[model samples]
Target: MKLLRVGPPGAERPVVLDGTRYLDISGVVSDIGEEFWRTDGVERVQAALAAGTLPEVDVTGLRIGPPIARPGVVLCIGMNYATHAAETGAEPPEHPVMFYKAPNTVVGPNDDVLLPRGSAKADWEVELAVVIGRRARYLESPADALSYIGGYCISNDVSERAFQLETSGGQWSKGKSCETFNPLGPWLVTADEIPDPQALGLRSSVNGEARQDSSTADMVFSVAHLIWQLSQVTVLEPGDVVNTGTPEGVAVSGRFPYLRPGDVMELQIEGLSTQRQRLQSAEQEA
Candidate 1:
């Protein structure tokens, strides 16, 4: 099932994409929140679709908001892509390196990505984000980890190198938590639809020039492993998001210039969806 949120940013209505048309399931369920997914929202929607008759809406010219509501936590894995780490002069991590992006940083997929005030060195990272379907605590192995995943979506992990490296001293969140940094969705392709999460192609481009082109196969710790590993340390609640990290060819490598105001970023994950973000200054947005 391809689930999405459409309409204006804050006033988005949850809907399911059926081919070229979008079904308005708002009458059946509210926002696609934690409670919704945890309580079998997807199945309920499927039942509604099976019944055949339902209200539909035109999404042309409408904004595509993040499919899920503000997640409980936006967990991230750093250097999960071996080649991406190499480009930044970092060694391959033996274990998944975890981090977080403030939940409030999330915004609509095509919304203008803001360049934080006094910022430079803003970069792009096209990543595959995993959304949890249910509560997950200590797990025995990576084997059952797939059961916890609800779906996958396209995510651009926008970063500011100066704040992440120079001014941050050691912490990266300072640079990662800028408002509108995480642009997600077009649709959340449910887990059942994705048989192999580790084999999808993901790529990104800046203003029509290709930047990162790689696959989830390059992840040091695959989605299942990351979920299982994280569960051993903390509780993975429903509606929590996990950014599986990006591939090579980021601006930080010096091969390309950092993102500046007026820059445009396009990102995609195979079989999922694509997103385009136009860069603007904080002042421009104001």
Candidate 2:
């Protein structure tokens, strides 16, 4: 099932896409938040759809917000893609290299990403994001990791190289948490709908020029393995957002110029959804 949150920024309402139509599910569940997902929101939405009593919403002026509202933890995996690591002059990690993005960075897919103060190296990372459906702590093996996931979404792991490399003393979160840094979702495609998340093709473009175009198969550590590895150390709860990492074509590779005000970034993943963000001055958000 494809689930989405539509409306203006903070007032987004939950809706489900049935073919090309968006049905309002807010009557059944308040919003697609932690409580909704943790309490079987998927099943409830399914039942509501089966009953054929949902209201059809005219999504004409409604903005598509991040699919899962108020995600608990925005966990990210770095160097998950071998080529991406090579492009940034880093070796493949022996294990998943993790980082945290402040949850407030979550914004609508089409929202304008604000350029941080004195930032000149704003970059784009088109990543496949995994949304947790159940709490997982210390799983048995990688084989059993998919069971804890609810679905998948598209996440643009926007960053500023200066804050990430030249400043923070090796902590990556500083560069990763600017306003609208993480543009997530057009929808949260349920796990069942995406039988194999690793085989999808992902691409990103800056101002209509293609940049990163790669498949998830190139990942050094698969989704299941990352989940299993993460579960070994921390408890991943329902509604947690996990950005799996991007491909090689980022600005840091020196192949393209960094993002500037008015630059448009578009991200696409096969079968999942797409996201586009316009670069704006930081004060616009202030």
Candidate 3:
């Protein structure tokens, strides 16, 4: 099932995508959020669809919000793709390199991506985001990790090179947690629909020109392994999001010019969905 949320920013209601039409599931469940996942929301929605009781919602001009509600935590893995690591002059790590992006940074897929004032090195990173459905702790193996996932979706891990590399003194969250830095979802394809998470193709383009075009197959750490590895140290709770790193071809590599106001980014992961966001300057902070 492809789950989604549609409406104004704070008014989004849950729905399920059936081909081109969207069926209102708000009557069956609240927003696709932590509580929804904890109560077997997917199974309830599936049952509603099977019983043919859901009504079609006309979302002709409403905004499409992120599929899941605000996550408790937005975790990110960096340099998981060997080629991406090589492009940035780093060697592949022995284990997943993890970081965090503020949960507030998440915006709707088609929303404008805001660039901080005077920013000169903003960049785009197309990644496959994993959404957690169940609590994941130490009692696990890589083989059991798949059961903890709820869905998969597209994520553009937008970054600011200067803040991330130059002024960060080594921490990555500053550049990564900027407002609207994470544009997620057009739809969250349920786990059952994706039997093999490692086989999807991920690609991104800037202003219609190709940037990162790669596949999950190139990732040094597979989805299940990353989850299992992370569980050993931290608990992955329901509705937490994990961005499984981006592929090669970002401005940080010096091959492409860094993003500026007005530049647009388009990203896609096969079978999950696509996201398109335009870069814009943010108003000065109060």
- How would you encode candidate 1's per-residue C-alpha lDDT over 1-286 as one tens digit per residue? 9999988878999999988889999988898979888779989999999997768888888888999899889999999998989999999999899988999999988889999998989999999999999999998899999999999999899999999999997989889999999999989999999999999999899999999889899999999999999999889999999999889999999999999999999999999979999999998788
Tens-digit lDDT track of model 2 for 64-148: 8999897888999999999999989999999899999999999989989999899989999999999999999999999999999
The candidate with the higher lDDT, 1 or 3, is 3
Of candidates 2 and 1, the better by lDDT: 2
What RMSD, rounded to one decimal, does every model reach? 0.8, 0.8, 1.2
Q: What is the C-alpha lDDT of each candidate?
A: 0.92, 0.93, 0.93
Please, what are the lDDT tens digits per residue for candidate 3 over residues 1-286? 9999999999999999988879999999988989989999999999999999999999999899999999999999999999999999999999899999999999999999989976889999999999999999994589999999999999989999899989998899988999999999999999999999999999999999999888999999999999999999899999999999999999999999999888989998999878999888896332
Tell me the spans in candidate 2 whose CA falls farther than 4 Å from its real position. Answer: none
What local lDDT score does residue 263 receive in model 1, on the 0 to 100 scale? 94
Clashing pairs in 2: none
Off by over 4 Å in 3: 284-286
